[model samples]
Target chain A: MAIFRTCPDTGLKIHSQAEALIKANAVVGIVFLAIGGLFGIAVALTRWPAVHLLDPEWFYLVLTAHGVGVLLFWIIFFEMAILYFASAILLNSRLAVPKIAWGAFALMLAGAILTNIAIFQGDSSVMFTSYVPMKASPNFYLGLILFAVGALIGCFVFFATLVIAKNDKTYEGSVPLVTFGAITAAIIAVFTIASGAIILIPTWLWSLGFISYIDPLMYKIIWWGMGHSSQQINVSAQVAVWYAIAAMVLGAKPLSEKVSRSAFLLYILFLQLASAHHLLVEPGLSSEWKIFNTSYAMYLAVLGSMIHGFSVPGAIEAAQRRRGFTRGVFEWLRKAPWGNPAFSSLFISLVLFGFLGGITGVIMGTEQINLIMHNTLYVPGHFHGTVVAGTTLAFMGITYLVVPLIFRREIWMPRLARWQPYLFGLGAGGISLFMMGAGTLGVPRRHWDITFSDAPLSVDVPGTAFLMMGLNGVFAILAGLGGLAFIINIVGSVLIGKRRDKTVARTNPVVFDGGAAVAGYGAEGTMKVPGTVVLVATFFTAFVLYYYVNWKFLSEVWPLS
Target chain B: MAIHPPADRLWWKEPLATSEVIWIAVAFLWGLVMFFTMIYWHFAGEQNLSSEAYKISPEKFAERTEAMAAKYKVREEGDTGVPVVRPPAGTDIYMFGRLWEWWPVLELEKDKTYRLHLSSLDWQHGFSLQPTNINLQIHPGYEMVVTLKPNKTGEFSVVCNEFCGVGHHTMVGRIYVVDAK
Candidate 1:
C-alpha cells in the first residue's frame, strides 16, 4: 500500500491493511477511557457529600489506575495511530510487522489488566504521582514498567516504518506538516518512557528489598520527564491530528507553516525543563534553579503554544474566508458545519484546552504563584483543561471522523456522534473549574475526608464546588453513553453496515497545491519518509536526556549527605 | 501529483550579515537586565550568606527562655519575658537547606511567602506539598524554588513525594502554621 498523493493515481491508497492494529489499539484505548472515567467518577463520589465513594485506600487505587489508564493508555494508544500515520499512511507505506504490532498490543493489554488487579486488590495504591511514603504492591510497579515497555516497542515499530518509507523514497521535499508533529510527539514519548523505566525499575528493586537504599527525591525529579512531559506529548500528537483533520475537512491550512511547525517543535525543545515547574512549593530546592528551570524555560514552551493558538485559528479563519462565508469575525463561526461531529469535537477541545488549560498552567508554573496551587484539586482542574477536554475529546472526535471513513460504513448514530464531544467537554470543563475553585480555598487532594486531615490548612473553598464536580461526572456518564454509541457505530459499520460497490477507497489519484486531491482506486500505495532519521534522532535525544543525564542526578544523593 | 510551493514568500528573509551583530548586541542588553534580578541570590547562596534557615532542636528551642535567650538573641523577648522567634509578617523568609529525605523534619511558619530554596541533602527529593500537588525538584546545587503562601492555619505534612529509598514511604515533614499575631 502506497500513500495517496493525488486522486488519479490508482497506486495511491488511503485504507491501511494494518487497520486491525489500529482497531486493536483503539479497543484498548477506549476500554481505558471508560475505566478511567469510572475512576474519575470515584474521585467525584469521594469528594461529594452524597455518594462518598473515596475509601482512602480505594481512592488511592482509583487515582493510580485513573492516571495510568486514562492519561497513559487512552492517550498513548490513540497517539500510536498518529505515529503510524506519520511514518506510513501519510507516506503511503505499510507496517514493518503486523504481527509484532499485535504482540505489543497484547503486552499492553496484559499489563493494564495486571495493574488494575494489583491496585484494586489493595497492593500498592499510591496515586499516579507515586511519591515516596506511599507504597503499592510490586505488581503495581511491574505492571507500569511492562506497559511502558510495550508502548515503547510500539514506538519502535513506528520508527521502523519511517525507515522503511525513506528507504523507498515515495515522495519529494520535506515531510508533510502532520508528519512533523507526529514525529515530535514520538520523540517526546520516547523520553517519557525512559523516565518511567528509570523510576519504576528502581522502585521495583526497592520493593523487593533488593536495594537497601533508594532516594524518593531522586525518583521524583526523574519521574516528571514521563509524568508532566507526557501530557505535552499527548497535546502535540492530538494537535497534529487537528491540523490534518482541519485541512481535510474545512480546507484549513496553517497561516504560516514555519510558525506552526516551530510551535510544535518548540514543545520538544522546551517541555523537558518546563516539567520542573510542577515542583514549586516543594522544599529542599534552590530558588535560583527553580526560577530558571521552571519560570524562564517554561515560557518558551508556552510561547510555542501561544503561537499555535494564533496560527491554528488563523488557518481556520483563512480557510473559511476563502470559502466566502463572509459575515464578520463571528460569521466564520456560523458558517462552520455545526452538524459535523469531528469539527465540533476538535474546535471545542482546542478552545477549552487553550483558554482554560494553557492559562492556568502558565500562571501555576510561576515560582511565587505556585505556592497557591501545588497539591490541591486545583492541579487536577488545571490539567483536565488540556488532557481530558483537549486531548481525549479530540481523539474521540477523530474516532468518529476517522473510523467511519476507514471502515467504509455509515456511522450508526450520527446524531449521537455529533453530540458526544460537546457533552464530554461541558461535563469535564465544568468539573475541573469547580475543582480549581475548591483548591483556591485550600482544599487538599488525596484525603479520604477533607474533614479528617491533620494538615494545617485554611481557606474553605466551597462545598458546592465538589457538588458541581460531581454533577459534571453525572453528565460524563451521558458522555460515556455517547462514546458507546461510537463503539457500536464502529462495530456495526465493520461487521454489519451495508458496503457500497465503490469500496470507498481513501485517497484521490490527483494532487493539487494546498488543496484536496483526486480520489484513487485499488490497493497500490507507497509511503515516503524523508525525516525518519530526524524523528528517531529527536527521540534519541529525549532518551538520553531522561535516562543518561537525568539518571546521574538520580543515582547519587546531592549535598553529600 | 504535483507538489507546489506557495505563490508568495514573505519579505522577512532578506537579512544582512551585520544584522547578526546588531541582534546579538540587543540580546546582550536584555540579558543584562535579567542578570540583576538573578545576581543577588547567586552571591547570597554562594558563601552560605542566606540570612535565614536553621536546624533547631527541642533543647535549643526550650533553652531560649527570655532570661536565658536575650543574651544570645536567637529568640527575642516580649514585654512579658516570653521568648519567641518573631519573624515579622510579609518578611521574605528565606529557607535554604537539605530536607534529609523526610518532612515534619522541616518546619516553616504560617502567614508568609516563605521563599523556600531547597535541595536534597543526599538523594534527589521531589518536594510535594499537600492539598496541592505542587511538586518540584530539590536538585543539589541546581536549586528548586517555590514561593509558598501558607494560607492554612494548621499543621500540613511536607513529604518527599518522589519515591527515593527503602524508607521512602516514611519521609515526612510538618510545617506549623501558627495563627498570625
Candidate 2:
C-alpha cells in the first residue's frame, strides 16, 4: 500500500506523499518569500530617510504584510516541509495520514490568503504583535486562528509519522540525530499553536463583538508565547538542519550523541520561557516573573544553544580531521569545502547567529540592560541576526541539497549559488549591526522617521545615528539583491533545470552504510576537535566583551536617587 | 547500497567527550554568573525599573494629570505649543498619554528622584525616554510607575516607540530636567 522511490542523488527512500507535500509546501513558501521580501525591501528603503519610499499608511500596512508573509507564512511553510522530510523521508516510512496532511495544507493556504487580503484591504494595519485595544477586522483574527489550527494539525501528523516509523520498525535503534531535533521543533510547535489558539479565538470573538474587552497586558503575555516561541521552533529546526547538512556533505556524525540530544531536550523544557523577555518592560508583570524568566531559567535555553554551537562545528572539524586535514588548529577549518555553498552558508549562519544574534539576545535578555534597548531598532536588529542570517540562511544552504535530492534537478546557476551566502550574509549582517548601533544612539523601532521634524517635541539623534540608518538602507538594498539571487536560483532550478538519474554521477552524494546502523558517537581518533574548541573560545570572548560593553552603557544612564 | 536502520545503539546512553563536559560546565558557570549579576543589579545597583505599578481608569488618570499641571504651573516657555509643568523635587508626578501627546510636560529637578506614573488614555503607547533610551509600554488601564532621577540637566525627549496608529511617529513628549538647587 506504500510506494517509496529511492532518491538517486541523496540515496534516501522518499515516500511519494512526502515528496508531494514537501514540494507543495516549499513552493508556497517561496511564493510568500517573494511577496514578503518585496515589502521588506520597501520597508528598508523607507527607513533609510534618504529614500523614505512609502508614506506612513502604506508603510504600516506593508510592514504588517511583510511580517505575516515572511515571518509566519514563509518560514512556517518551509518548516512544515522540513517536518515531513525529517519524519517520513529520514525515517524511510510512509506518512501516517496523507489525506489529513492535504487538508491541513489547504487550511494553511486559505488562512494565509485571507490574512494577506485583510491586510492589503488596508483596515487591519495592526503590526505583527497586534497588541490589543487596537482593533482589526474580524477576518484578520479568523484567518490567524485557521492558520494556527492548520499548523497544529501538521504538528500532529509529524508526531503520527514518527509513531508509524516506530511501529513499522523503519529504523533499528533510536531516531537519527536530525530526526530527534525535528521532534524538538514539533513539540515546540505544539505549544506555540496551542498558545495562539487560546488567545486568537477570544480575540476573534471580540472583533465580532461577541466579547466586550480583551485586556492589553493579558494579550501581550499570551501572544508572545506564540510569537517568540515560534522563533524558538526555527532555532531548533535550523540546528537540526545544521547537523543534517554536515552529515550529508562530509559524512559527519555528532561529536557526542547524548550531549547534542540533551541540548534539544533543554529546548523543550526552557526555550518558551524566553518569551518573557518581551514582557519585561510591561507594567503588569512583576520583577520576580521577569527575573525568573529572563535570567535564571531562560539561561538554560541559552546553554542549550551554546552546547549545539560547540558540537555542530566540532562534528565538522572531527570529520575533516579524520579525512587528513589535521595540521594546525584551524587546518581542518581552512581546508573545508568553501566552494560548496551549503558548507559556506552553514558556516556563515553559525558564526553570524552566535556572534550577532546570540550575543545581542543575551544582552537584551538581561533585565537591567534591557532598559536601554527595549523597543529600539536594536530589537529588530537582534532578530534579523537570528531569523534571517541564522534560520533563513541555514534554510537557504540546505535548499541546495534539497533541489538535487528531492526535485532531482541540478542548480541552474552554480556560480551565483557560491556567492549568494556572502552577499546575503554580509548585507543582512550589516543591516543588523548598523541598526543596533543606531538604536544604541537612540533610534526607536517602528517609527517611520527618526528625525521627527513635524513632531511637537523633536528628538536629538546624533549624527552617527543618521549615518547608521543610511548605511542600513544601502545594506538593505544589497540584502534585497542577494535575496533576489536566491529566489531566481531556486525557482529556476525547480522549474526548468535538467533532471538527473542513476546514470549521472552524483557529486558529494550522501553515502549510507549498508544496513549497519551508525551511532552518532565518533571514535576516539575522530574526536580531535581542537579547531572547534578554539572557535568556541573566540565566540565566548566576543560575547563577554559585548555583554560588558552594554552593561557599562546602562551604568552611564541616569542613576536612581 | 541497501537502506538500513541506524545501528542498534541507545546513543543517549553513551558517555560525553571531554570537550563536551568542559564546554557545558563553562557555559553553565557563565549562566550562573549572569543570574547572580541580575540579583546584584536589582538590589545593589541603581539599575532596572523594578518600581510599583497598578491599574487605573483612563479618565481618572487624565484628571489627576490635569490637577498636577494646575498645582505646579510653570510660566517658562516650552518647546512647540505644549505648556511646561515643573513639579517640585521628591513628588509623585502623573504623565498621561492620550491619542497623540503626553500631558502636562513635567519639568523635574536634577539629582532628585520623582516617582513618574504613566498611563494611556485611549490605546497602548510606549514611554520611550530617548537620549537615555529607557522605554516602557504604557497600557491604557495600567499605571507604570518609574523612579526617575535625571543626572543631566537638559530637556529630554519622549518618543512613543509603540505603534499606536497612523500618527504614531509624531507622538512625542518632553521632560525638562533643570539644574539642581
Candidate 3:
C-alpha cells in the first residue's frame, strides 16, 4: 500500500529497492555500452582493408575484442539491466537480492577483462563468429564461455525473482507489457547460451587436443545458434525499449499488449531456428537443410519484424489519437518530437534495423543468393544495422529517458541527448549502402589488407571511394567517442549531479516509469521535457563505427599462410 | 510447435503473404531460385556448375586452356598463365570437377549466354564463380548447371570451392573473357 524509497542524497524514503535494481542496471548498461562502443571502433579500424590501422596480428585480436566487447558483453549486460527492470521495477515490486545484482556486474566485468586480455595478447584471431579450425587461444574461448555462463546465471536470477513475484500475486493480470517483452528476451538468451555451450565447450576441447573431431559444419550450425540467435535476444530487448521509449516520451502504451507479447514470443520461436542461415554458404550442409533453414526461416523472422513495425507505430498512433489531435493522417507524424535524443535513437535505430539489416539478412538467407553477400563487407553492414542501428541505438535512446528516472538525476546535457540519434542513423545508413555495393564487387571479410590479390579476388581501388567515404563517416572511433559522451552524461548525472526538490521527489521517484500505474496513480508523476537537437550526434558515432568495419571488411586482406 | 500452414491454403494466407506483401514478393523470388535449382538437379541428376569437363592441374589447365581456347575463346593471357574472364557475377557456372580438374578451359567472352553443366568423376571439387561470389558444388553424385554471361572483365577465380580432400586449397581455375572484336 505504501511506496518505498530512501534517497541517499535527500534522505527521503520514496521508492523501493526493486526500483534501485532497475536504476543500477541502467547505470551498468551505460558503462558497458560505452566500452563496447570503443571495441566497435577498434573492430571497424581492423576491418577496413585500406586504412589497416592495426597489423594482421592485432587486427584479428581487436576483431575478437570488438565482437566480444560490443555484441556479447555490452548488449547482453544491458539486457540484464532491462531484465531487472522487468522482473522488479515494471512489476511494481522490489528486487529479491540487490547484492546478487551487483554480483552479476562483477562477474560480467571479470569475464570482459579475461576476454580483452586474451584478445590483446594476440592469442585469439578466429574473427567474431570464430568459425571452427580457424582457432583462437584456449583462454579466449574459456573467457567467452565463462562470461556467457555468468550471463546465464544472471538470467536465472531474473527468472527466480519473477517467479517470486508470480507466487506473491502482486499483479491483477498477466505480466505488464514491458516485463512480458523482457521475459521473452531472457528466455531467448537461455537458448542463446545453451547453443553457445554446444559449440564452445567442444571447440575448446578440440583446441586443446582433448577431443578429435568437431565437424566444422556442425560447429557452424551451433555457433549461429550462439551467434545469430543471441542477436535476436538483442532484437527482443530492442522491442522492449520501443515500448519503454513510447511510454516515456509520448506517454504511450502498447496498442495491444497481447499482440506485443505475441511478437516477442514469435521472436523466441523463430530466432533460434533461423541461425541455420549463417551456415547457408558454409561447407557440408545439405541443400535441402539450407533451403529449409535460411529462406524458409526469413519469412518467420521478417513476420515478427513486420508485426513490431506496424504495432509499435500503431501504438503511437492510437495513443496520439487518444490525445484527440484529429489532424490529417500525417498530422501525428509532424507533431511528434523529432528532436528528443531518446526519440531520435529509437527512430533511427528502427529505420536502420528494419530497412537495411532486415533486407541484407534476407538476401544472405537465400540458398543461391548467399553467394553474393556471405563473408563480404555486406555482412558487417547487415549486423551493424541490427546491433548498432537497431539494438545499441535503441538502448542509447532509452538511456536519455531512463537515467533521470533510475538514478534520480537530471540528464547532464539534455540537448546533446536529443541530437545524437540522427548522426548515428545517417552514418550507419551510408556505411550499409557502401558495404552492399562492395559485396556486389566481391569484397571478402575478415582480411587484414587488400593490397595482394588472392585468386578469388581482383584489385579495384579508386572505384571503392564511395565506400571509403561512407565508412570514414561512421567508423568506430568516432562512434566510441560518441558513446563516451553518452556514458559520461549518465555517470556524471548519477555521481556528481544534485537531486531534484522535495516536491519533485515526492511527486515522482522513477524518472521514466512509463505511466503503468493506470488507475492507481502512484506517488510519482512523469515529466514532459521539450525536445532538443543533440540526438543526431549520438547516432553519428554509431554510424561512424559501422563505416570503419565496413571499409575494413571490404578492402583488407589478411595474409594467411 | 510447428505452425506451418497447409501446403494448399488460399495462397494469400500461405506464409509471408499473410505476413507482409512486400516480403511475400521477395519470398516468391526465393521460391523461383529454389525451383530453378531443383530443376537443374532433376535434369543433371547432380548439378556442378563449371565449364571444365576434365580434371587437371593449373599447369595442365593452361595446356588445356590452349586446346579449349581453339575450341572456344581466350580473353586475357598472363605471363603467370592465369587468364581472366568475366562470368556474370550473380550466375552459377556448372562444370565437372575432380581432384585435378582443369578449371574453365573455355574462356568466356563478354556478353555470351553460356550454360555450364557440371559434375565430378572423382572426389568432390568446387567451382567458385566470382564477382557474384556464388559457388557451384560438384559432387560425384550431384550435377549443377550455371547459366551466365560475362558481366565484368577480370580474372574471376574458379577455385575448388569445396574441400574434397588434400590439395583442396591449392585447387583453382580461371575464366578470361575478352572484349568481343
lDDT of 3 by residue, A171-276 (tens): 5446666776788889889998999888899888988989875655466678888888888888888988887777666656543444455567777776777776
User: Where is model 3 more than 4 Å wrong at Cα?
Assistant: A1-28, A43-51, A97-103, A295-298, A453-458, A465-481, A505-561, B1-129, B135-154, B157-174, B177-181
Which stretches of candidate 1 lie above 4 Å from their native place?
Answer: A1-17, A296-298, A453-561, B1-181
Please, what are the lDDT tens digits per residue for candidate 1 over residues B1-181?
1011122233123222232223224333433333333344244321111322233332332232222223322332223232333334444332222323231122345545555445554444555554333444444333433445565566454545343433333454444567765
Candidate 3, residue B120: CA error in Å? 17
Give the number of the best model, judged by TM-score. Answer: 2
State the lDDT of candidate 1 residue by residue for A1-561, as single tens digits. 333333222333443545557766776787677778777777776766556766555666677788877888788877876676566666666777766777877788788888888877876666677765355688888888888888889888888877776787754445666787888888888988998898888888888888665555466678887898788788788788777667656656555555566678778887777657665444355666776777445356665665565445555555666566656545666778666777888888887886667667765665544544566567787888889878887887777655544544556666776776777778767766776766655555554454433322222335665665466456545545555565666566556765522444423211122343222111001111112222223432442343223223222211101
* Candidate 1 docking DockQ: 0.11
Alpha carbon lDDT of residue B10, candidate 3?
28
Give lDDT for model 2.
Answer: 0.85
Clashing pairs for model 2 are: A517-B6, A517-B7
| TM-scores of the candidates, chain A only | 0.84, 0.97, 0.84
**Cα-based lDDT for every prediction:** 0.59, 0.85, 0.59
Superposed on the true interface residues, model 1 gives a C-alpha RMSD in angstroms of 12.3
